[model samples]
Target: MSKIDPKDIQKRMDRISEIFSDIVSHAETVSKTRCPYRNRHDHCTAEFRCRNQQAAETEEAPLVCGHEGEFDYRSAWESNPLLHARATKKLDEIGKAAAKRRADARRKKTD
Candidate 1:
C-alpha cells in the first residue's frame, strides 16, 4: 500500500470538521424557533401536547404543526395528561429516595 500523506489527511479532517460545524450551527439556529417535535413535513410527531398542534383534516392523519418558526418553541410544549403523570411519577420517586435517606441517617444517629 502507498504511504499516507499526513498533510492530505489533515486537510481532509479540516474539511470534515468545517462541514459538521456548519450543519451544527444551522441546526442550532433552526432549533431556536422550530419545535423539536415538528417533523420535516410540518407534522407534530410528539405524543404530548403542544400549543401549536392543530388537528389533522382527517382523523387518520397526524396532527399538523401550526408553528411558523416565528416564536420561541420552548413555551409551546404545553402540559398533557401523560406528561403530567410522568412528572408526578418522577416527583414521587425523588420524594421516596429523600425519605429513605433521612431514615437511614436517623438510624445511624441512634446507633
Candidate 2:
C-alpha cells in the first residue's frame, strides 16, 4: 500500500532519459566518423592511415589508433567532458535501476 514517490520516479525517468540522449548523441558522432577509409579526395589523416583507396579498401578499427577519434567512441567518451558525463550518468542510472528492481522484487516476495 506504499505510494511511489513522484519525485523519485521523476528522477529515475530523468536519469534514464539523459543517458539515452547522450548515447544517441555520441553514437551519431561515431557514425559520422565512419566514412570510407579511402576516398579520392583523401580526407582522413589520422595516425591510422586510410590505405583502403585502391581496388581493395581495408580500414582498421579506431581502437587501433592511439588518438581519440570518431571511430573510437570509448576514447572519445573518455576525452570529451560532455560524452564522459553522459556515459557516467547513464551507467549510474542503469545501476540504480537494477538495484531498485532487485529491492522491489525482494519486497514483493516478502509481502
Candidate 3:
C-alpha cells in the first residue's frame, strides 16, 4: 500500500486552512446578518450549520454555507481573490489521487 506523503498532506492542510480562514474573514466582513442554521424550530436542513447559534436566530441574514447551505467551500472560495487559486490547485491534487485509486481498483478487479 502506498502511503500519502506527510509533506503532501501538510501542504494540502495548509492550503485548506488558508481557504477556511479567508472564508471566515470574508463572512465576517460582508455578513451583517446572523447564521441561518441556528436555533430553528424547523430542521437545520442546510448542509452546514452555523456555529454562531445566537447570531442565526436574531440576525436577519445569516452567513450561509458556500454551497447554498451545502457544506462545500467552493462557492465562497471562488469569489475570494486571496486564496482561490491555491485552494483549487490543492483540490485538484486530491482529485487526481482519487482518480488514480479508482483506476487501480479497476485494474485489480480485471487481474
Candidate 4:
C-alpha cells in the first residue's frame, strides 16, 4: 500500500468540517422558525401538543401543522422543558412507580 500524507488527511478533514459547519448553521437558523415535527406533507407528527397544531377535519387523520413558519415555534410548544415541568415530573414519577412494580414482580417470582 502507498503511504498516505498527513497533510492530505488534514485537508480532507478541514473540507468536511467546513461543509458540516455551513449545514449546521443553516439548520439552526431554519429550526428557529420551523417546527421539526412537521412532516413534508405538512402534518404535525409530534406526540406533544403545540399551539400551532390544528385538528384534522376527520378525527382519525393526523393533526395538521397550522404554523405558517413566520415565527419561532418554541414559545408555542408545550414540549418546552420550562413550560411543561409538571408533565416531566409526572412522567418521572410514573417511571419510578413502574420500576417498583417490576421489582416487586421479580421478588414474588423468586419467592
- Lowest lDDT sum, 10 consecutive residues, model 1, at 73-82
Pairs of residues clashing in candidate 3: 34-62
TM-score of each: 0.69, 0.33, 0.29, 0.63
Candidate 1 has a TM-score of 0.69
lDDT by residue (19-103, candidate 3, tens digit) is: 9999999888644343333234433323333342223344565543323343433333323343656777899999999999999
Question: Across residues 53-93, which tens digit of lDDT does each residue of candidate 2 receive?
Answer: 22214465222323234353233332434565687789999
Q: Output the worst ten-in-a-row residue range by lDDT, candidate 3.
A: 45-54
lDDT of each: 0.89, 0.56, 0.56, 0.89
> What TM-score does structure 4 among the candidates reach?
0.63
**TM-score (C-alpha) between model 2 and the true structure:** 0.33
Clashing residue pair totals per candidate (backbone < 3 A): 0, 0, 1, 0
Q: Which one wins by lDDT: 1 or 3? A: 1
Question: Which residue runs does candidate 3 get wrong by more than 4 Å?
Answer: 33-111
Q: What would you estimate as the lDDT of candidate 2?
A: 0.56
